[model samples]
Target chain A: MNEELKHYNDRAENLILNHLESGNVSKMIKDASIYSIQAGGKRFRPYLVFATLKSFGLDPAAGLSAAGAIEMIHTYSLIHDDLPAMDDDNYRRGQLTNHKVHGEAVAILAGDNLLTESFNVLAEDESLPADIRIQLVQVVSRAAGQSGMIGGQMLDIEAEGKNITMDELVMIHRHKTGKLIVAPIESAAIIAAADDETKALLLRFAEYLGILFQIRDDILDVEGDMSVTGKLSGSDARKEKVTYVSTYGLNGAKEQLELLKDDAEEILENLSSKLDTDELYSVLQMFAVREQ
Target chain B: MNEELKHYNDRAENLILNHLESGNVSKMIKDASIYSIQAGGKRFRPYLVFATLKSFGLDPAAGLSAAGAIEMIHTYSLIHDDLPAMDDDNYRRGQLTNHKVHGEAVAILAGDNLLTESFNVLAEDESLPADIRIQLVQVVSRAAGQSGMIGGQMLDIEAEGKNITMDELVMIHRHKTGKLIVAPIESAAIIAAADDETKALLLRFAEYLGILFQIRDDILDVEGDMSVTGKLSGSDARKEKVTYVSTYGLNGAKEQLELLKDDAEEILENLSSKLDTDELYSVLQMFAVREQ
Candidate 1:
């Protein structure tokens, strides 16, 4: 891992851990919330917030709250998505899923807590101007809410056992997975008070990175081994679920991933003069070719 | 309903309806979101927003978005609370629950959408100063998050079929249902930018109102007929749920309720010099005796 990226990840984990315990909520809820978030992932979303801030030459601390907020939103979505009534997955991050470990009701409430906590964390951040923090709330809410991730999840649910076109598939991933991926970058830019042009460039970078990440996920679902990925191989296909790989063959999906990677690199290159790109590019490279 | 209260309710319904439609999300998610919000209740949260604004002599329109936001949050909680994994309720507000009307997955997403949309609506509201809007988000998030309503729910869920002390029951109700009920009134005060003294008084009023409301709800659960309350009588008792009525006994609980009502009315009286109390008192009186 990039040392800077690793540092940010550690900071994010700490921020989230500390914030979860700062409240006087019941022990059970606080534990459930902590447990769910502690069930770790790649910390991709928070990394974006930090990397974006670094790119703007701002201290990564300025983006920590938003970073933690986005990650909380991501964790909450995953917790809910893995519910018995939703995906019913028994494992996540190579461990028993939230509902599988905590009873279904606890898991549901846990997700709700994380979601609600994300906003509270951001709203309470003293690092940013109150106005910017509010903007972060708005952006994060839109991305995490019905118009973005939740809406996509609904469509994904509705798409199950049904044939969906390529457009529908793109729409789902863009919302279900894409919006959250984009949120932290936007939030960081808002916090950094980056110029409109710079913010635009960051957004473009995030958009391509989001699609590329989903494409890689779909590809991995088909091509990777379960032992390496911690995910059941061919689960999407087994469920008869549509994906970029399902819509376009594995080869085509891989080809698209490469194209998006190039596009992202080009955007970063375009903004290389405006901000540091090495750390951002390194993080992007790490996510781009991960086995898991 | 009082004619003024009815006007605010209708306006709230319209704002929610329009906002849901304005989004470009899938028809399925949109419909699910709309269905839950349109399930039809007393719109008490939104009413509090308007009533608070009215008491401050501000145009009710100034409270519209915050009203809509609180209603959306309330609706989302209800949707999620009724899920099969949670309360497994099949009916809400005398109509089929969201999960029952839609699939469990859709219902979950719909609730999520409402929650996310609530922030968006508030963030996007042009009526209030940006700083006040941000304050609204902060206050609402805390009240709704793990420390407040969601945390309360965790306690409520854990308390089911178990013996609990009076203090524990009060804590559960205060967090589970009290925080949200208190949110709108606080939000309106923020919007009105009332003095610290006034805000403190409103918070006190809200605390009393919250306890009063939950006691009434518990009383209704025990004494209310389904035909009038749109809920099953003794359902809480049958579930072995701990409630004010169960913990205090009906007479004791009723006494407490009267005491809280008096406290609330007194606070309103104290604030009458700073803000009009007629509409506020009218609304409180209506809720005080509400059977449903």
Candidate 2:
């Protein structure tokens, strides 16, 4: 990414990181949330939101509410899925799972709070025009609900320990992980009041991004160093979980990522005249190939 | 409460319950949801929400979307709280805990989905004025968040396996159990487009009723019959959890509940002339004394 765009990404990440550290949230439930929300991952998705808003010539502030809300929702899911009852993993982003550190019940409720808490952040944003506020909330509620992330999670739970086909796997990951991935982009477009054309294109971009992102994680689950991934390599071994790498093999997964990235790039045809989100496309490419 | 009100409530409950039963939700999950949501408990809160909207001259159709949403939020929390991970609950509304039958992970996700899906239900109400739709969401979101339910859950979590003062216990229930209680009344007033004066009165009524509702649960936990409560007696003793009855003794708890109920009744004087929420008031009393 160019230096100017890098600055925007850095600034947005810092802003989110700072808010995550704010003292207002009680330490009673803060550590687990703080660990995951502030985990040193790239702010790639949230930045996409800001960039998408900027692309539509809206103030970056116009999208900050959804930006923070999306990130919190993302973080909440990660915490809960790591609990002993769900994915039952121990380490995440190289840190102990929330349940491990905070105890299972608190971890569960923390996730609940985080997900439920998103609306407060979004609604409290007075900067949003009234009409747009309704749209933003409606879109988000749908995405987070059964037809979106929760539905994906249900499919994921049922898909485990089975030899699933590629299509089944896609449905699992798209909902399990893809729905939240799409939220930032769609929310940004909603914030910007992007016309139908822009909304459709950005949605396509998000779909491609979700698959590419999930593929990259599956690949890492096989080869990433423990020091970096925190979780053990080969962790996917026992679940018989379906993934591009699992179904197509590692080399195949790599190729699939490339094809999906290409799809993402092509959709940028709608944004050819735009500048701000161009760098977001570049960032997605890097994310597709990043180390743990 | 009254012949007409009871008849209308039964009609509304059957409407929502029948539609929900026909849903393609997994049979096991569907049954689990019905166990609590359709249990013979009064549907007072949802009834009030619909009634409040009608009092302001809005169509009953406008209330249907939120009716299910609020009930789901209430049901999900009960399911999660009764789980081994949280309260280790075995009984709710005199029925087996969801986890007891559906398995913990499914139960957890079921609750999660219900909470997330509640928002989905609200957002999908395309017929409501966009502004009012957003307002309903904002109100419910605040009532359910950690600062509301999640926050209360946190406090309750912190107090567990410890000796907490009566004030602290009251605070916990106010959010833990009470905000969910507060949601129906506040949301009803909001949906009705009641003026500030009427809205304030409605809130006052909800707050008083909410605390009273909680104190009864506390009292029941101490001495309620398993036949009626659908669980082993001395419910609170097993957890050794602090409760209003535990702190104040049964008679004192009863006195406190009476005070709160009286306050709720006093607020009834200022209710708008068109709003006939007497049935709701009686339901509140029934909810508080159902253990008998």
Candidate 3:
């Protein structure tokens, strides 16, 4: 990852943790929210928002709340996805699950609280331009709703251990994980009032990054250790889930990631807007090849 | 419930059910959403909204979506509340629990869909006045968030085994159950442009109904039949959870409901703006003395 992008990643994570800490939840709920959120997955999605919004020279402060809100929503989704009835995973970030610590009910409610808090942060704030705020709200509602993350989830649930085509798998991952991962950048572009060409390049940039990330995730599921993954090793193997690595073989998956990384880099290079997304783009390049 | 209220109750329910069914989802999710929402409940709150808006000579069409949104939100809460981690009951309104039918994960997600859909139903449309939409959005948000339903839920969670004071129980029920139950009417009042005096009386009317409704619920838990309830009989009794009937005894709970019902009736009868909440208030009165 580029040094500048890494710095912003840390900045976004710390801000989310700090803001989330200040919210009023039951002590148990607060602690549970912090535990899963602070478990520290990559914050690339939020950093895309902060970096892209700032690439236009807007003060990062102007968008930090939205950045934090997006991350919270992301973290909440991860928590629920890791629940027993969902992914049935026992570890995250190489640690015990939220439900393992707090029990199922509290974990569920904590996720609920975080998801609900995302909108509260957006809607209650009066400092942002109302039109921009409304735009953000629309972006978020669609990105998170049934046609987006939830629909992707439906596909994932239906595809496991089943004969699913590559297109179906791509569709599932795109919505399930790609939507949120890409949303930050596209939303940032919209908020920054980027031109159509710039927006399209950014969208391409996000798609490449999202697919590369998912492919790497599938690879890790095959070979990554529990300690490194903070999750069970060979989880996809156990679920017999069809994945990029499973369908295309590890070598094919690696080649796919390389192709996506090059595409992302090319888009960043071609953008007319003089922006620091190159640093973010470089980070995706590193992410495509790096071990956890 | 009064005969007039029953007519509108049917209308309000059919309207929401149709809107809900129009959404694209798996049969399981659709059934779960409908399962929790389609059953009988006194739609007093919705009636109050339409009546208040109509009485103020505001457009009733402006209130329809909000009315539907409130009922869905209410039904979602009931579904979650009946889950094993919350109330753990197997029945509601003499029907099988949502979790029992759909399993817990789908039930939980169905609740989430309803909540998300509620906001989308408001924000995505241009039917309601922008200002009223914004204001209604804030009302529903606050009512469902930490300081409202969640806060009330936290109290209920904490108060489960304690020496329960009446004030504490009232506070829990008021915030947990009352905010949502009361919000529909207040939302109507806001949209209807009801004067402050009338709004105050409507809130009072809702307040009485919410409290009286809880008391009746407690009384029903004690005497309500297993066949009708579909719940394992005496589940609440086994836990010895705090309730109006538990604290006040049956006769005391009944008397309290009567007094509260009378107070609510007086508020409506004396409403200065000549707002008509009579039919709705009558439902509250019948529900107060209802045998389930």
Which should have the higher TM-score, number 1 or number 2? 1
Per-residue lDDT for A150-269 in model 3, tens only?
Answer: 657665766667788888889888887887877787778767877888888888888778788899999988888666666566878787788898888999998888888777777877
Least well predicted 10-residue stretch by lDDT in candidate 2 chain A? A17-26
Ranking by TM-score: 1, 2, 3
Q: Residue-wise lDDT of candidate 2 within B50-106, one digit each (tens)?
A: 655655666655576667777778778878888888878776666677888778878
lDDT of 2 at B148: 77
Screening candidate 1 with a backbone cut-off below 3 angstroms (N, C-alpha, C), the clashing residue pairs are: none
Question: Which candidate gets the maximum TM-score versus the true structure?
Answer: 1
Local distance difference test, each candidate: 0.86, 0.72, 0.72
- Clash pairs (backbone) in predicted model 2: B94-B230, B146-B150, B146-B151
Rank order by DockQ, top first? Answer: 1, 2, 3
How good is the docking of model 3, as DockQ? Answer: 0.37
Q: What C-alpha lDDT, on a 0 to 100 scale, does residue A25 get in candidate 3?
A: 37
What DockQ score does model 2 reach against the true complex? 0.48
